[model samples]
Target: MGTDNRKNLRLEVFGILKEAVSILCKNINFLIFTIIVSFPLLSFMVYYETFLFKTMVETWDLLSPRDYSNYNRPLPYQLITENMNRDFAYKLIQLGLLYLVPLHLLELFTMLLTIDLASKIYSSEDRPLTFKEMIEKPIYKAKLSSTFITSVYVLFLSTCTLLGLIWLVINYSIMLRNFIYNVLFTVIYGAAFVALLMKYLEWSAQWNVSVVISILEKVKGVEALVLSAYLCRGSEKRGRLLMLVFFAWGVCLRLPCLVLGCYEGGFGMVLQNVFNSLGNVIKWIACMVYFYDCKTRILEKKVDEEVGNVESS
Candidate 1:
């Protein structure tokens, strides 16, 4: 790759921030529409998740005393285990299949509206696909999503390989405090993996952003990825640093119950509320960054290295 313009990314950061503020000012109506329409889906998800019992144990009504008088004897552990597993597997299959119908529509329609908003709002100042433009350019968006998914899957596999090696060590023979070491390794490595995942996501955001432009205008993919990577040499650290900062912030959100426990009620009670809302709340921030990342990545300069090589030869 050509020498990366590290200094240039500072300007990019400022530009994105400015675009964010301006877009926020202009798009309140669209934002409201997004939230209002998405609310029903969100509400239904909550109902399905909480009421329907993700597991049969949570929702099932077993036969009463009169009906089960002959079944009073304690069941065999293996039989009980098999029954529990069967119930869990059944729920898992149903839950997975049930959402595909709604998820497909959201992915196909509602998601497109949001992407369109992103593309329109962020298209200025060399931004590639705005929230709006993505809807406008589905092929490019698909390519971008495909690239991201492939990268994450590869990372996951690599992590699994390393974890497999550790599993062998802990299970194969008598190793000193092997269980303790394994747990410690998981804690340390899991934190590091989360950090890396954040940085990797930011880096990939910089890749293939130009495809939004290309798909809309009919241009090059590799060129977009490379040029964006090159342009992002400096900004990587800033965004990567933000990821770590956010991770720490995330830690604070996670530990609120512990902090709350000291002031008032039992930890268990506090924890129940915290855990219930934590995932969805964190996802809210993620949804916003989804747009921000796409904006910066699309600004990459277009260049076809493959064509250049061919001509040179």
Candidate 2:
């Protein structure tokens, strides 16, 4: 009986994967828009992060003159002095205050527009929208707000789970109390950490479509999460499998860009970042396709039951 259940689960997962890919492939143009809309923003983020770190390091060097012989010392040692780099500190504060608002707006726009585009593409009742039409159409500002809140919800849950697991491990494991690191302890602890991380990922899969719900149903925040979980209740396995595949794909495709960026700067990093963003777009498109399928199935099931009740009456 267990074997049969496992086989059925495998079959369902495969079917879901196939259908999701099919839907994405059928509307490749939507996927292109997803890439185009976000690629510039992603590239800017990559460039900006690299620039920020380099600027800080340069400022640190200028503020605290260090001999080449002391290169082996840790970088944080520069800030150990009673009088730290006031100029660098001021610059950091200025940078943060300057970029916070604009950055938040850009991020919010990206999430809302990409999700809105995905929903429109996957929605059968709606026709494909042009770029201008999408912008000119009154944006559902509430959906964007909800998406931000839902993200906070997930982040808080994940952080709590991680902290709780860490606390439990420390309390339960005598080896950890003294920070002992024998081979046996290392293996056991490593395995436990991996298991916890896997569990967190699986739990997070439940909320994968919350943004989809927020946009389509105009439900935001906790309500979107509740609706998303309800819709995905029976399809948990499929959601996990989908998330696993997407994670694997990201590691395979986007990981290289980060590795490459270390050695190759300037145009090379920008080009690689663009490709990585495109890969992310493809992933989101597939995610949207899966969300559409799950939603359609739920709606159809509800309609069928309602029709049966009416017929009996």
Candidate 3:
């Protein structure tokens, strides 16, 4: 049994990495598709960075040497308070939002395309979808709606969790003066923390397939959330394991940026963006694969249970 368990663990590790590579190899067109769609955003990023550099230089020059000596504070605070012009900052922000909004819209369009492409690749036995067909026929409404709802759910849960932690910390600190109260508070704090953590994990795991559900089942909003919860209830560990693999894959892909930063001089920023975008491509593929895997497992398990019930009867 132990040997079997160890073998399973080894296989699980091997499988995820192997599948990630396999997906990358099989999905070169998707990378091309993403890169093409992302060009505008990348252009904006480069332009904005250069503009920011020039602005920073101008701001620094505007602050005379005498101004620096007047304030005994951190450079960052001084930049905001002393050197920084509010009107300039406001203008920068306005200029920024103009590009940023469109960039994000392009990102959304790219994601829709990717999600459509993944559904075709994974969920069907059909031939690979061409980019044109993928875009033309792909469903968008459910994906958009479910994503918005999921975002709200995540934001709300995250906010509540943070507030709860802060409250616990503050109350626990105050109660620590009394020995009995401290002991009682510790137990309560530990319990609350564990409960909240578990809840967060469970909700997060359930939302893993919200996108897949949106694409496959045409479910949206709260209905999608409810369905995802129903599907993912018993697969919390697997969901978390997949998430870890996704995180690790992302970090490994971008590790070169850190290495390059250490050795390379000015051109490192350009290389970093290229590497990061490439990493994003890999990240998108791995994530879609993970989503498909989770959905498949749930569906197979569900079918098996139904079959077992039929056989027993």
Candidate 4:
């Protein structure tokens, strides 16, 4: 019984993976358009971050004397004392938050295209979407699904961070308390994060579903989620294992870019670059895959249930 269940799960997840990948491979033009739309906005985000840091440094130098021998306090102390760099950093942070507004819209648009492809992949009949028609009228059943997806992740991360802070503050009095507390908190919270990641696997899958169903007008978001979860129910362990597989794949891809980023600067630059790359590339994919399979599997399950009901009822 267990073996049968496991086999079914593997088959369903395989369906989801093929659905997602085939869409990208099949609809090259739609994928290109998504990237093209995102490039300018993404480039601006990079430049805006770059300039903010540069400006902050320039402001610091201008305020301070070229030669600080005459000053009573040391440079680091003086910067803190005079309130030198804090405001610049704060402003840059605010700009980053605001910039996401445009990026969010761009992501939403791409998601619409991706979801359409997923729906078709699972369309028992394999109803593939064409480039010309898809561009003109994209699917949106998964539009709000994708939005809710973004919301859940942000909320999960925020909740975890708040919990960590509480643990730190409440236990600060004991000797070595913060250290021990942090270690324990990290483990527990890390597990929660993993579960959250697991739930997110549907993000990519969900959107793909939307795109697929746009033409057929088959399933909505709620049905899609439940169905996907069911299809992937037996494969949870294998699904998680696939995550580890992707994790290694992603690390290998970014390692070279990270090394180059390091030499592109110096020692401090090296560490910072590597850290940034890890955050953006590695973590980004993990979050993406979590949503990818979760949604696909749920939708696959939904498809079966719907089909069963139609034939039975």
Candidate 5:
């Protein structure tokens, strides 16, 4: 019975992807328009991310000049001078303000537009709104405000998660130097890591759905988040799976640029941006499909319970 249930869950995840693809194919014109609209923004994002990655690498190298021949030996922590640390911190702050903030805002704007179009497409609404029409809607401002709040909330949690992971790494490294405490540290760290990861996934699922809710409904900010959490109650597993699939897909698409440094220039760079934009489009559509699926499940379950109550009475 458990095996059957797991299989069914897997099928539902695939169903969401299949439905997203179906919608895209049926609306090729819409897809083309989305790609054209998204390409410039996404390309800038790709370039910005690559530039950020290279900057960090250069900064690290400058701080800790290492011999490539002695790759096996880890760099001594003591070698990093206080001045280097301060410089690194300053550089991070500069990058965050000038680059990261704008990047995130652009990403949110792209997602807002994509979700608006995707929801309409999925529902087969009469004459899907163009970019101008979408922004003109009175509710559009509410959606923007809600998404901004959501972004800030998510960013705060992300920073906390990063700090937690850093703490774990520092403690783990300290424990590694003391053989006697290895086993205890390993057990405790393993449990903490798993707990943190599960919580992150749970919140991520809620965050994605909440974005959809903010755009489609009148609800904004905390209310949308609360509704998302409620709707995802019985379908948490499916939500996690959907998140993982897209996360993996995105990583796979961008991994080559990171590994090969192909994003430097020319045709390779153009191809990367194009593919990333398309992936972004599909990912939002899949999330919209998943949102509807979860909503339908919740509604059906409620109807079933109401009928059962009637029968009992």
Candidate 6:
């Protein structure tokens, strides 16, 4: 029974992908428009990521000690200092404001537009909206506000998760001098890390669906998040699987650029941006489909329960 349930969950994830593809094929014109519109934004995204990677490498080279004389020092000593150079800090701040912030807003807009379009295509009731119409909707303001709030919350949680992992690593290194204790600590830390990661993934799924809820419904901010959590009650596995699939897709798309510094202009770079944009379009579409499926499932289950109660009475 458990095995069958697991198989069904896996199939549902792929089913979402299949439906997304079907929607794309059925609306080739829409797909072309999305690609053309998104191409510039995605190209910027690729460049931003590659630039960010190179910047980090350069920053590390600047901060790293030139001498290996203290190589035997503890892990905490090897970590980057809190007191970063003022010039470098200012440059990073400038980078964030000048490039990162605008790019992030653009990405958010792209995702929301894709979600709205995909939802329309999936429903088959309303005609697909034009870009201007999409932005001009009254709900667009609410979506933008809510999605921004959600993004901030997600960023906070991500920062906390990273700090927690870093703390664990530092503590583990501090205890490495004691063999048995280190072994026990390692086991406990490993378990804790896995648990932390799983919890984060679950929250990530809720956060993602909340953005959709914010767009499709009248809810915003915490209310949307609460609704998402409620709707995802029995479908956590499906949500997590969907999240993992897209997360994996994004990593695969960006990993090569990071490794090879694909930011340099070439045919390969253009192809990467094109494919990345398409993937982004499909990802939001799949998420929209998944959201509708979860909603339908919850409603049907409630209807079934009410009918059973009526029959019993």
In the order shown, the candidates' Cα RMSDs to the true structure are 11.3, 8.6, 9.5, 10.1, 5.9, 5.7
Task: Report the Cα lDDT for candidate 6.
Answer: 0.68
Residue range 205-246, candidate 3, lDDT tens digits = 466466456655667667777777776666667666655555
Tens-digit lDDT track of model 4 for 226-266: 54445445555655554444545545644554445432334
How many clashing residue pairs, candidate 4?
25
In model 2, residue pairs whose N, Cα or C atoms come closer than 3 Å (at least 3 residues apart or on different chains), thus clashing, are: none
Local distance difference test, each candidate: 0.42, 0.59, 0.56, 0.45, 0.68, 0.68
Q: What is candidate 3's CA lDDT for residue 167? A: 57
Stretches off by above 4 angstroms in model 3 are 1-17, 41-106, 138-208, 248-266, 310-313
Which one wins by lDDT: 1 or 3? 3
Clash counts per candidate, in order, are 13, 0, 0, 25, 0, 0
CA error at residue 83 for candidate 3, angstroms? 14
- Model 2 scores a C-alpha lDDT of 0.59
Tell me which of candidates 3 and 4 scores higher on TM-score: 3
Clashing pairs in 3: none
- The residue-level lDDT of candidate 6 at 70 comes to 52
lDDT of 2 by residue, 1-313 (tens): 3322322232355555554454345555655655566865785666565555455455435535355354332223343343356776676676564345444455456666766765555454435556566557667567666777776676567668767675445433434433433446656766777677676656666665776666566777788788778777777777777677766765565456555544236665566556556555555545555566666668767999999999999
**lDDT: which is higher, 1 or 4?**
4
How many steric clashes does model 2 contain? 0
Better of 3 and 5 by TM-score: 5
Q: Estimate each model's TM-score.
A: 0.43, 0.62, 0.56, 0.45, 0.77, 0.77
Q: Give Cα distance to truth, residue 178, candidate 6, Å.
A: 13
Q: Which scores higher on lDDT, 1 or 6?
A: 6
lDDT, candidate 1, at 232: 50
lDDT of 6 at 149: 78
